[model samples]
Target: MSQDGAEFSFKKIAIPAFGPSILFGLGEGAILPVIALSARGLGASVAIAALVVTLIGIGSLLSNIPASILTDKYGERWSIVGAAGLSMVAMILCAVAPNLWVYGLGVLLIGAASAVFNLARQKYLTEAVPIQYRARALSTLGGVMRIGVFIGPFIGALAINFFQLAGAYWVGVVAVVIAGLVALSMPDLVHEGGAQSATGAPTVRSILVDRRRIFLTIGIGVLLVGAVRASRQAVLPLWAEGLGLDASTTSLIYGLSGAVDMLVFYPAGKVMDRRGRAWVAVPSMLLMGISLLLMPLTTGALGLLLVALLIGFGNGIGSGVVMTLGADYSPARGRAQFLGIWRFLADLGSFSGPALLSGLTAVISLAFGVAATGLIGLAAGAVLWYWIPRSPKTPS
Candidate 1:
């Protein structure tokens, strides 16, 4: 490449992507908190609310490849715009839906929006960063994105409390639109190659077929991610209300956790760059599992805040290490599809963890539900611990 060829910076992309990314991240984080309550407000039962999450997961699973193909065929910019546009529609539909069945369609669309937006965003990152710096670059991006998420729910809660359900929906629409527009402003990476986006015509089928173990690992990571997230996003709102707190406070707690993620995420990435992927990810996962185990026993905000810190720290490692590893393992061709494999399962975990854990509490107890999820996370860490191949670290 010529020295005069175009180059990118964190400010170049991160600044524009930040707004949309935040909207996307926040929606990713907050919906779990709101879904059950919103359903109940529309007169759905606990059983059905659980089903709502399951259905969303199904939609995410269905949309993964199509989203990748669309990104490849059209371009990353349009893919995100299309997704955000659909999400705007979905949220409005969700607010107005008269019945659970129609509401389910809204949920499906929301999941689909995430699929495309995520693919575009990741492809953007892959195209923008150099290989030596890729891990930290992705980590920095994750940290920023998490900051967006951290801000969203707190504001959403204020809207929910001040203006009721419609207010919350309105806030979400604005966020989706903002994110979409920012995506529009960014430059597109037309040609995919080198350390950045993939080059060549490898089939998505080959990537998925040969990397079954990696896919499994991704699934487990997603489950744990979604599992830990569900505890806060899906179940915590209900738990908080049961404790007699308002929606505002619940959002604050969620927001605080997001803040913690932002603060620690970059530092964690640096450690991964210096130490190694497994070195950081392994301990982060263990801490995350331990934090989940601790959540049920802690009844006070202070205790919960500490738990959030631990969980956030663990997540910081994962957000960096996992993406770095994904980029490393994935061949230059069909990178989006491989990242989709990474994201697809995690989204499944995100959708499933809340509902499944909450549903389990019906037969047992919330304490048991939290504990079960935490234990599963420990197993996930162990799995990654055993199998994550060590790659040669690039010179700084």
Candidate 2:
């Protein structure tokens, strides 16, 4: 295949590349809205329940390095299968747990499995897709997951009507099992480059050392991008609540925003592939930043919705950018390891964004905190503009 992904038909690999991700996203979405509630049902206080929700991110953060190693050693297919199995077990445990501790464990396991599953699939696509089509393939992957997540809550609601809160976990169980089966059925593609290590496979530590420059530079922009993206979830709801909007109204606004978000992924990818990463990346950050900066000023649903839509559009267009950039910079020798670190940095920013907001809100005001986060978005756009390569690098 040519470097441009010539003669590649996305439809040919659609099932293997995107099917499992949809299932996984469905399972994850089904469970996310209910985790804190589940913990509360098991006797956790509000604070403790909230803490339990954070455990998922904590688990993912802790597991990234290990997940990378697993992917490197076992390859993407088995790792995905294994992760899916783990997810099923976690969901079942959550469904049947006697107390909050056990349920927390289940949630943590779910996160760990997610890390592995996501990393494996990303590495798989990075290897299998041609360079020219890479952005489109990855953006589609991101988009499909968003689609599944968008549809998942309705499925969970239907399940809940019949079986109550536990039904959501059951939905997760079913989703992951199907995902695992899909993964098992996928045909393995040949990776283009052989391992680079002379003595043996490079350790994650060694890969980190070798790729420190990329991590320190473009990686910082990725971190800020992640921070802004993740913060949007918290910012919108909090602002809505502050404006006296009810839960249902907030949810409707959120859903509308997500609808906008899902619409642009494919076009975004096409632009990146044809033009450059910066064309999409810089604009995405700027739009999100500008939307966030305007969010604090909204006092009505219409204003909030407009700003939220803009944020969604910005985020939507940036789909798969981080993964595409990671794949571009990845060394074929230690590709999984490199992406592992990349994901870790991004995840760290995700965690930090909320924390930063909370701290700033406590010290000043909610408006100030949110606007500060917007500034971070603008800063990220600047960094990406300066740092992102004009052309995608073919993995060495």
Candidate 3:
């Protein structure tokens, strides 16, 4: 309310939180690519490896609503700390697991923990950050995440060389422990108004019943976008390997793409805030679609590298766009619940995408998987083009 309080800088307030955020990203990045690879190495087929990778999304989908409920009940601090701790435990399990089934369970736990951690963090940011700066703040958060992810795989590559693929899980364990420690020691920033309804406490059923139109329309588009994005992560290493690229080169190329994505993070947010979210969302989808199409055409490392760069550029331009939009549409009352449903749809899409791709690859060919994602991306762009402009500016 006072002039001095208004001048309190986000940079100072967010530093402690940033540490955990980046570390979490690093841990996920280091371990996730290797999950599928590890599964394949453990005698699973390519399709089975993809199923293992999809478990993360499936776990997140299962946990989203529960995560929101926990955050609303307990607040961000405990939710994050507990989730980080669970992530560390899951990493340890993955490291020592004797079979693909056990490793998949660990990965599933990581995903569930991730859902809780991410929802809590997003809730905190939505409540604490000023509206004028919201997009940029979220985008910068995405950038911080991108930075760790970009750096993680390179280190993971080294770890794999020295200690084998499971070594990546060790790196993840360290990163998760560091993140949990940082988060535990940090001060909790309390916001003025908690996300509760004016009439009474809101239930997920009520929110869905009330916002069904927006949920079905723009939500579908969001789902498709999330699907394409998740497919990119799940398919890339497998695709590269299928094309005969070595592990180190694949990691390097993927890391470089992440670098490109990080570069545009802030700018993407700026564009969204200034020109409306559509400006970024539509273009990103189009670019991503083009990249997916080109992916199947890649014959070697260089060609894969080119597609990776395009996917990075596409992904970069939409940094934080999903969260920004989620915040924009969420009712201040019951924010977490709304986000829970929002993210559930997205996570469902993410799970189904890779599963669908794996099925398509098994039935037809990898090229069909690529073509399907390309088609989905293009369709998603069209949905955004039509839906975003007509949506109400304020939460109902």
- Return the top candidate by lDDT: 2
What residue pairs are clashing in model 2? none
- Using Cα atoms with residue i matched to residue i, what is each candidate's TM-score against the true structure? 0.81, 0.97, 0.87
Tens-digit per-residue lDDT, 146-214, candidate 1: 776666666788888887876667777888888888788877665635443334465578778877776
| Lowest lDDT block of 10, candidate 1 | 1-10
lDDT by residue (tens digit), candidate 3, 220-266 = 99999988998898678988989888889998998788778889988
Candidate 2 clash figure, as a count: 0
Order of quality (lDDT): 2, 3, 1
What does the lDDT come to for candidate 3?
0.83
Give the per-residue lDDT digits (tens) of candidate 2, residues 1-396.
Answer: 222456667777789779999999999999888999999999999999989998889889889999999998888999999999999999999999999889999999999999999899998888788888889888999999999888888899899999989999999999999999999977676665554455578779989999999999999999999899989999999999999999999999999999999999999999999988999999999999999999999999999999999999999999999999998898887888999999999999888999999899999999999999999999999999999878765557
lDDT of 3 at 241: 86
| Model 2 stretches astray by more than 4 angstroms | 1-4, 192-198
Q: Candidate 1 vs candidate 3: which has greater TM-score?
A: 3
Candidate 1 — which residues are off by over 4 angstroms? 1-8, 26-34, 53-55, 157-163, 190-200, 216-255, 295-305, 355-365, 390-396
Taking every candidate in turn, the Cα RMSD to the unseen true structure, in Å, is 4.4, 1.4, 3.3
What is the RMSD of candidate 1? 4.4
